[model samples]
Target chain A: MCDLVVTENGSVVGTEKGRIYVKLHDEELTTFPSESLESITLMSNSTVTTYLIKQCLTKNIPILYITQNGKYLGGYRGVTTNKTSLQRAQCELFNTEFSLNFAKKIVTSKIKNQISLLYRHKSCDDVSTDIESMNNLKKRILFCDSIDAVRGYEGRAAAVYFKGLSRLSGEFAFDCRSRRPPLDPFNSMLCFGYSILYNLFYSLIETKGLNPFFGFCHADGDGHASLASDLMEEWRPLIVDSSVLSLIRKKMILKEQFTKAEDGGVYLNKDAIKTFRAYIQNKLFQKNHTVESVEEKKSYFDFISHQVSTLIRAILQKDFSLFE
Target chain B: MCDLVVTENGSVVGTEKGRIYVKLHDEELTTFPSESLESITLMSNSTVTTYLIKQCLTKNIPILYITQNGKYLGGYRGVTTNKTSLQRAQCELFNTEFSLNFAKKIVTSKIKNQISLLYRHKSCDDVSTDIESMNNLKKRILFCDSIDAVRGYEGRAAAVYFKGLSRLSGEFAFDCRSRRPPLDPFNSMLCFGYSILYNLFYSLIETKGLNPFFGFCHADGDGHASLASDLMEEWRPLIVDSSVLSLIRKKMILKEQFTKAEDGGVYLNKDAIKTFRAYIQNKLFQKNHTVESVEEKKSYFDFISHQVSTLIRAILQKDFSLFE
Candidate 1:
């Protein structure tokens, strides 16, 4: 019921007598009962046996891959989630007014989460203008006639929000949000954590029997998990951004642990990657009270799962109200 | 340039200093240069490192997994082949008159291949009646207006084809074509070889950026690579059946190498699996003169790749004439 993160470069993973075991340089590092594993994340250059692949597929545990710099490199899927009806419904929803509305709801919630994070750090940094801008942008989403307009507002709000976060970074300089190869440590950690969160959302969406390529918010395109990307948008500030900010404020991941490439792209080293992965896993599994259900504390995993379930229901019933 | 078949149980595969290495129980068994690998196939309980997976992905080498009994469990894909226009065209061709015509061509070609195989073994077995029936079925396919009718004719043709194959089996028992758990040794080898061939087609179909699920010849369903199945139909007799027949006739795989389960299902054991895998690999890569271009020799792999490319052209142009 937990994520097994294997970050060692030369480690080999395989199953032995129904138990999953990890080895590094021929020495057995550890073994876990298959039941204890919810999913597995392999970072850098670790190896896995076909036996482990088979066991993961049989147990429905996804095996995700991340590059050394923390870019999500997809994963080995078991039997594809194959609900034709759900996919049909999802495809039908695309390019409709309902899709536009759904996109607006997602964008607004994302902005709201960004505003909430900014307000929480208001005492430490003057984020009043960013918060106000985000709030106004959230309202403007209601008037968005197209997905492009919603995307435009979301992009503008992200710019204002990231600028506020830069002020909150203190010692860690974050001039602007940079991806591919993050320009700064903060951006590096943010991109890394976002990649993890994106994969998490991707797995959950596929598990819910929804086509990951079709989406209401993100436009359908080749080679992109549009639906998963769409779902991750709302949770970016709530999960990844929050986890990254906590790591920076707690000094858990130092800037020295990150190395700059010749092209000036920052990347977390092996040990720092381990720390970041552990922190993200803890953040995902930790339970916290929500604004709507203050009496019931829910883990980030539970919240994301609930959102996916609600999205499926919305698609099936042609009703976005319950999801919103 | 050839497939790296990893059949050793407990063997760990990884890359060390840019060379792909296999270690068993920490003993260095062998290594290969990345450029020397075309694809990878893992059988039984072998292990592979994430580094190898990354290497394979980066090199665009596909890793296929097959169970001990030779059932294809699937493989780890790198970046998905993403030509949106190709996929769109493929989906649009489904359930159309073109689809029906295209399906007829596939079925006819399949039946013709069956007849050709029967004729090749005519001197050894009395397959005249079966060959005649297949010819009639192939002709019937041309008049068929529906895919189901084409499938019906195809099934009947396969029934006749397998019967003739059984007559040609000599010492091996092949009462009928039994799958899931093949009922006899010949059926076991046939199924195993077909599984490999099916996966080969599946990978090629995806690499061409055509939707493997939306197939003109086969009805789409849950968890099935219908397009792969559709394309594999024509190649079954040409590749798998031909290989299995040669193996049986040549005694390349002995009958004792097969084992029967408690429920009376037959499967190839570990050693026989190696022999079968090697034979199939040889058969796929072996170049020989073909009927269409008798002066020029083409490998089976070339034939399959050409078929896939032709299929793409057919879909794009909305024309099946060139493909047929």
Candidate 2:
């Protein structure tokens, strides 16, 4: 695990006796050794003392500063190690057979997981018709000649997938995958879960020295961890969606646990968010069977690192099949 | 993942298409396909439709019921899967050399990981004196005469170890390792994290078809997953402690996130618990270095199942070293 620190709301991380410590709100304190740390995330209102900065620079740990809402402020790192050549290859390989194959595999994997989720909550009668259409969509995406076509099929399948989600009914209904402020409780959980998921995938991508902004399916965007997105697609239903269904249906999260904004945006009450996060974490790490080759029953938790490592390996070998 | 559903605060989980659907407050609905779900957790004050119960029983899915505070409230499982022979072997093996070796190896692994964590975060000067004692304790435990002796050293070393943790000053401090309504935030986090860890390990034990109450390090206890506890020891410091330190030091958790009980107990405030759980979940599944035979940079997560599988293999082969 990387020893990364992220401080917020006027907490300053500094060094004491060669170990990292934090002084918060001018009173509270905490310390840690920086040996295993790979980076530090400094949110708005967070401060990094000069000594801590120097040690991070010397040790080559990147310090990422972002806003309270998680906008990327900037990053601090020692410049001796760079990946300019690798980034060039990432762009070059985006439209190649490698990217095409990887994207197809991930999309197919995602659809299959989505179908499986539908089958879980739906009766034989509920999903019986949709399953054939989904299976057809999977094959259509698998045979698409271009990334754009794959994206098209994916969008269509998502429409079907999201509609089927409505069948969950009661407290856990998804009416199209709404975003931004998350217009519904289910959407709020999904959005919240995905945000944590993105950060996790981004961290792994950064550690592997890959360009998170360049991905096969997702084109380059302003400060986006696009590659992380590409890697995360196959896992969305498997990890986040499954957990959402389990948590809500299992009654771990309820309707009263959410608050609606004046704009009709649904947000988890202060209490539900914790329960959501904790439950999601448990769900992610809890062991289960996956298509991935593992020693025994494996938790979806390792898939982030595992898949990212596979991406790096595939890129280095010019073999996209290695991914996923 | 298990099909078990925990219902509390008024939620009902039912079946739709061989899938479990949860209805909350009679208005909200969430569904999960029962495929891959091994069981359902039924908590108190929850209702299950007759059709759903019949489906679960017909499908042979066990429904484990617990209290809101998480006490075992019995279970609704399918016809018994007898383990007469395995239970006999487990009981006979508990006090044998097999148990002794498995217990010793786990202690050694735990000590090694602890030393690594200390060296990682400890100021060289602070740990200089403490390191020698820890090293000697390691050796002493290695050569201890009996299981009780090994337990003794583990306890003595804990005294020195807990003292060293004080070096992590500021808000991230633990006076001692406390449980059962942990008295400090750190301890509370530990207790909560361990609870989830126990469930994860217990699930694996059940899957392995081993008796959870029979174990090597921990003797049989009333209603305890003794084998899970034994398996959990090597991992507690390796996984949980490291994450606790990282999360607290990273400032991902804050001081204001806790509440003071009128009786002077510490508990995670409404918000901190979510962040704490989510962070721990991420930490548990966050990829890290571990001593396991694998293809890539493996996380300690797989070790949960890996070690259990090893335990099963060792018992079958009568070879104890397989556990480590």
Candidate 3:
């Protein structure tokens, strides 16, 4: 059984054993018998004596020390000369691969589609405005932009993109609403697309050996890092945004297939969702060849991220690219 | 034995019969006589025709419609309807209570002390810089004094706050490296503080009727609503932030107790975390009486979000508050 231990101050200590201790000023506290304590997070500030340290070392307990603000201080093992190299190596592999995959997906095809989808709904006049804002956003990110500028414009850009994407998707699914209605195609597509992106990012992040909580782009907190969101940004247009457009334009699915509910909301019918899933799977794994002679087959997602990483590496190395 | 229908597309379809004919574009799609169809999604679009619909309705076979994008179209036998209502009701109740609780926490606390704790750090100047950024961030949030401002800044402001928070947190955690030999007392305090806030927010959000995704301040997407992050913001100063300041100012958790890891990281032993967790719990749940006779007995977290929401509601209603 998975046992979750939520301490008094909201520090959740999950372990197989249900036992936990509350330490006082200088005492070693345990609420239960000396059972196996699999995972213990020290969110307390009691004085650490050598005896207490030795006891933990003898017990071989893995302890995570975190600040009150949720900053991970580090983990404690009884042994001083632990194999840190293995941990670092594992983390490096995970981070590098994850970053590479993310970049491959973003630079080539995904970013273009995401940007296009975001701008798809804007009036002809507003297209430039959207483009301009995006360009500015890109510039800020590329220049290792001022922490201030990056911080300042991030939320606004996110809002514009989110609202724009939602509106465009809604429009694409409008015709299908009254006639076929089962679920809101737009919302479903968004959710499905996000889910896929999230799973991919989550897997990659987990593989990297880094605590997802310790992230660069997003904040650190209970809900921050949002590795899924960070990775999804580049792919949103290509996968979700384009998928919606294709479904609408192809007329493979019709509006009559959707159904409206009592809640004044819409959903897709079961058949429709099945069809959509097939389409997306095909899209993700679709092969593409960049050069005529190379004869290389790569997922559109993979190709895009690879390009993005190259661009990112260039930017980091101070070699300028159009991505900036 | 429960047998699932296997389809070419890898979706599972269930049927009472041993086998069923699935309409496909090319050949008459047929499957072996099995307990059920493993992949029901591969069933041709024609399977959902009027005759099939009527038959399904009469037989009470659970029918689910999905879009090509894997959006849940409605399902038959009232499963979708019931589930949707239950989910919605749950969301609404959780949102209201969470909001009320959070708001109450902020109004009754020592505001400056709370803010300082969230922003303070002892290990590096980078942490201090992060703390300083909070003042500007607060100003940015407060400057959006009206609903219009809130809406205008909603996207960018939230993003900036998230970014600032992440950066600040990263710095305080010493760039995700191990802490130094002389463990930063402020670091442990903040970490413990954050854990508490995270747990509190997690609980409140669980109770709220809102889909943590459908957040007002943050945009919507896989990572956007980050309800946990949103909730943590309000109590950053008082719980985690303030605890750090107090710990350092009073030297509750000493620097010597923090040991260096083989990886050159710093961390407090388990004893420290336990001690701090208790201290935080006491402070958060501490009750005080005010002359106004309003029950000031709410948890610190409850007070934080309440104040933030009150500010938001006042802004929405166009009533001015000092937070501006």
Candidate 4:
């Protein structure tokens, strides 16, 4: 009845018109496809005719014989090379189902953390430029509000201003005026944070047919961390920034935990590394002490990686809103 | 004299005050520990005291048993609780051996390439500046020679000026270009070139006990392609520049092979991809077709990866000339 049937024993059978018969001996049972309806007997030298097997083979049907105990015998069938096409079709169907399920899961997850970061340095003239850049990024994410507007005078000057502002914002995050040689806590956290995110992102990318190195936003270069960088961009504020701030505020990791080396470089110690790893794992798993059940808390990291992949799939299908 | 000696039949024969004896159904043989002996056997019913076994165990010596057919069986005396020390010692020994062999192979093979590169990139303006930069780079593999040298110069401008001068002076052979958006063929080639290098570098970093993401030359930040860029810096002249120049010179790929989309974005076509892949593989294998004899050539990609790892080992040992 079916185009092809794959049995639990990992055997494939194709059927057009054929019937299989079974017989039992003293302690053993055997099955065979035969044309004639004859009763099987013990101690009888029964033989299977080649004509019946040839008939099944020519008719594009395969009948595989199996004993009662699931011992496999051979089968007769026409040559089948269309299995690859059928397999590809099946794979696509599974992928679509997986994407839809992942999307639904993300939409319903309780892992939302929204934070706005603004760079307020002594040299910068306009603080609103930072706000404006954040607004533009938010708008791209489908958050449209009057506050999310970039109010600027000149196009060329604004472009240059924004470029400078972006570079300054990055520098501000890295500069530590309090410490000698400036231990960049923000960038350090980002390095570790992105590593974790990239690992998860790569797993999701592998699930999709796309190569991780062949990316959309990042230009390919020799040793370009294309996929890692691409995925980390959208998640910077939500994950890396939030994690660093929480760690510092909670006094889980202190400034003293960072050591200044002879080469004028500062790095986190083993204790700090252990603390950070535990903190990140907790954030990723969304484990909350206040929550009644673990299921009530959902990880934002997991949601983003899975949902972004689904969003990419939906975009390919011309469903842009899925990204929002 | 040994406390105990193994018999030929894989049985333990106890030596009584340095006098050992073998018992068989047909015959028996006795010998002193100082005397040369043939294959020996132990009777199954012979009553051998357990105190001897305990004495052997306390001494940390192995009990040996010999078969009638001249086979020997050995057993340790004491139990080993911890394997970490043994493993560490074994690893140290193995690494020493591997390093020595690798250094010999590389020195013999790569000295010519290194000399040629140095000669080709020789400049006149200030030999000390270039030498100083190269010396500094030798100290630390990841570096921005031109960026550190030229004041008030930005990204591609600094790279081009440095590379151009170096090429004119016969210090380098490849042309450097600014990476532009909407990807041109040169940029595309660079992109592909870097991706290949990145994958290979990551694989090597994984083999060595180092974090690929943590780098020296590249600044730490979110989505910074530090590890990939770090590995690529050393091999840029050898692999990427050479491949791109060869592709251009041979005319295996044309400018028309790159399609400029309606959106102004350019991408290489299928034919160009094939050509690029073939070129990359050829470079990776370092196959020489002109010479009649089959000479094995190490791929520049493989050489860079090995060079970095060897450098890391050398640093651990406080050996400075690993790069040299």
Candidate 5:
């Protein structure tokens, strides 16, 4: 269940007889049995051997590629699952009445979480009106008949949520949401956190044997893992936004720790990225993150696994009530 | 379009500055530009760095894995394409009337090639009756309305073709086609060769952005690349069987170069596999193999590429007449 993060630059990672070893020059740095690994994250310039890749694929341990500056590149999701029945079920369920219900659930749950986050900062700012507006939109999503309608409600809620977030910011300058080249440090952090959450969902959804491209709420697009984008909506505010808030509110990241790129995009600097990653790891794994719908206390990792499992079971049983 | 095969036992392959380099214990073995490689085949025990893999994947160069004894164990087929329209076309055409016609064509083409190979050895043995029986089955396949019936005819033709192959074998003891634990060397060679052919088609099919699991002739089974298995049928006798026969006729492999395993399966020994691989490479790449249907003179490499292109075009166009 351990996520192995290899940040050692210029080192080679190899596997021999099922044991993974790291070496620099002619010196063996470290070795461990690969059976305990859940995922491998390469965060720096390092080399990985084919034998290790073979072992990872055999164990279904996804190898995630992330840049040293905290941007998430794509990952090798190992082999596509051989579970054709599950894949067929997923494809068949898309665009059905069942899918619309699931889409509404995702939107409502996401807005509900957004409202909760806004409520957390109630003492710091007057976010009650925005929260009320989002609550109304969340209710309206239940009556949505089409995928586009659900997305429309979700988009409206995002407008209120982002505005509410700007008011809650104690020191950071925040405005409307911007991306591609996020204008402010606040939006940059949000974009970076969202990318990480999206890729996390991507790996989990594929591991559950569902087609990531075939989604319920999101329209199908070429080269897009639409389903991952759909599923991560409910968790974005809870996992990513909360973590970003913690880092900002605790004054753990200073304003000087960000750089404006040539394209006018603000990005986290190298030292700040290290602090950000450490904080995220602590929040996702060490802290108590619970599923409010299930009323169970667990780590965020378990929470993500539960959501993926629930989606697959709902698809398998042809029922959306399980999602509710 | 060169396929790089790495056979060094303990060498490590890495890429830097767009150049691929192989090393062993700090001593550089070889270096080349990464852009020149079309595919990579790992034949012996070796380690490949992640950088090389990333480059290969970005370039769409499939990395194939083969055992020291020539068993084709899967490969890394890189990323699935972003071509949603092409994928949609493939899925929509599956199990349609078009698929039935396509399935029949695959069987007929396969049987035709099998009959051609048998004819090549006509002077070696009296295989006239087996050839005629296969010819009758081949013609009947075109009239098949269902995939099961086409497969039934294919099975009957295979019975005749394998018997014909046994009769044509000059020195190898091949009574019948035995697999799993092939009882004789000839059957073992056939099994090994077919595995390679199947994987080759698997990589090619995925490279074309088609789902390899959804197939035409073969029934979709869990975990099986049915489309690869179906498509390779047309090329099996032409590529695998003919190369195997040439190995036997030219006395390239000796009888003593085969070992009987503890499970009663006869397999090519270490040295025999090398000779067999070299001969197959020569026949596939160096020989002027002509496509009789198009009256085109090309290498077996181009022949395989042409077949894959034909199948993809047929799937995209929704017209099996193109295959004809």
Candidate 6:
């Protein structure tokens, strides 16, 4: 009930005998026993079955499917045990005036994180223009009228911040935000990191019986992943961006490790992918103090789940201030 | 369990008292007691809530969500009351040689029906070429090396058949099989009909504890709806295509009852959508003979559920010929 049993790297398979078996080609490697295993993240080309998957599903143990290069493809889980109280509150407050206000809170928090990041890097000589632009956007969100306006300010702030990121010197040069086959080495790393963050938020949101497409900050639509997208907004700069920028600044991702496609799309070569995966995995184990409740150090994994609980509490109480 | 308790064409609200209160803009119109309701299909903008939805989920009573325009959006259901015998068999049989045989069976049946439809319309004298094309495709499927090849034949056959359908009548024209904002009225009707059929299959598959995405004909990718799509193939001509063609032939859908968009796409006008919904609902209640078990007459709704049970039986026996 407390911890995830992560089995990453190499091919893994499932069994009829209620255990997870890992392998490298034809060689049997290890088995994960089914006990106190809250979830399993498959980071390799793994084989599994409906029977074992159902066994995990019924117990509400999520099976997260990730690519070898650490892109989150999808997740599987059971019908959540009903928390009628929070579910009712979520349905009631959703798409109302209260939901709109909560969305504002989320965007405000996101802009705050962006401004804080700039404030931290302000001492750098060439960052004044970027910091000033972000600061202006943050101030505008205070008088924002619509969800579109909030999103407008957030978008503007990202443009300013990424400009600053590109100005950083090293192998991890930031370009424009390009995905759907990331066009550069830095963007490829950022995309993978954001996928993991989004998937983490998805698991957390659904455990509380909140519909992932129903959200305060995102437009409701089929297949939107709105709630997870909403929850990861503030954390994007704090977690994914910081990690990405650090990797670039430290020369962890090298130019030679990127491949150029005929169509001009750039991808992380295999060795580069291996290095990036290791860095992300290491980040999962690293602890940091929460910006809001600053005391004990907490892993990124723990902090994300706690964020979902805070969201649930916010929906139920009609107060979103806990989000900051 | 034999009959659905439907409350349609009104503004309805859910209550904690285990009954649905029908309302029309703040005026309480009627109420329906929740007993003997096998499922609830919301066919309007009518609102319902967590309390009654939770009540239905716990009892394994599925709640089908449909838009006013008769698009089947999604469904909510409980953890299936597991039949471990069938569940275990389904997993074991999936993706095996026997499952491949089942995929072959589905394609064979689908192609056969396409040929039959062409034959039935042979009085027109111009459909001979389409019939010959479909017959060749059907033969090619018998020698298909992979599921992709089988799917390739299926795709080709649809192209030939839709070409035939477009040639039937001037007003009942079809250009291509356009879904995702179906660009013509015929396509709009076809897409709506297909959605209903797919949703029906989804409910049946889940009731047998077989995962909808795990199937013989599918790649088993995330969110494929493979089983639903798989099961509905054999019935498409017998159901949706037949109903759509009949509506056009009967002049039930008029050309004036369609709208032209700025992008030159055609959509069913509101009144036309209402008419289409009625025809689909009526078809659901119309009795039809089963292709395999030809004894008792059954409604389309009953037949779809029976097909799932037959699939469960096939998985257990490892004899996919029953799928025929």
Two-chain DockQ for each candidate model: 0.41, 0.01, 0.01, 0.01, 0.40, 0.02
Name model 4 segments beyond 4 Å from true.
A1-324, B1-158, B161-176, B180-183, B223-225, B261-263, B287-297, B318-324
Cα misplacement distance, residue B83 of candidate 3 (Å): 29
The candidate, 4 or 5, that scores higher on lDDT is 5
Native-interface RMSD of candidate 2: 29.3
Count of backbone clashes, every candidate in sequence: 8, 26, 119, 13, 0, 0
The CA lDDT of each predicted structure is 0.79, 0.66, 0.42, 0.41, 0.77, 0.67
Q: Candidate 5, B206: how far from true, in Å?
A: 1.9
RMSD of each: 3.1, 25.4, 23.5, 28.7, 2.9, 24.0
Q: Candidate 5: global Cα-lDDT? A: 0.77
Tens-digit lDDT string for candidate 3 (B98-205):
333333332222233433543454342344544454445445544333333434433343343334433444324332211223234344455545644543443343
What DockQ was computed for model 1? 0.41
**TM-score, candidate 5, first chain:** 0.90
- In candidate 6, list every pair of residues with a backbone clash: none
State the local distance difference test value for candidate 4.
0.41
Off by over 4 Å in 5: A15-33, A69-80, A287-296, B16-19, B24-32, B69-80, B287-297
Kindly give the stretch of ten consecutive residues in candidate 5 chain A with the minimal lDDT sum: A71-80
Q: What is the C-alpha lDDT profile of model 5 across A42-132, one tens digit per residue?
A: 7776777766666666567777766654455555544445556676677777679988988888888889999999998799888888988
Q: For each candidate, give its TM-score against the true structure.
A: 0.90, 0.45, 0.31, 0.30, 0.92, 0.50
Report RMSD for candidate 4: 28.7
Please tell me which model should have the higher TM-score, number 1 or number 4: 1
Winner of 3 and 5 under lDDT? 5
Total colliding residue pairs, candidate 5: 0
lDDT of 6 by residue, B39-135 (tens): 6666654444434554565566666655544554455545334343443355466557776677778888987887787788777658988889899
Of candidates 3 and 2, the better by TM-score: 2
True contacts kept of each: 0.40, 0.00, 0.00, 0.00, 0.25, 0.00
Best by lDDT: 1
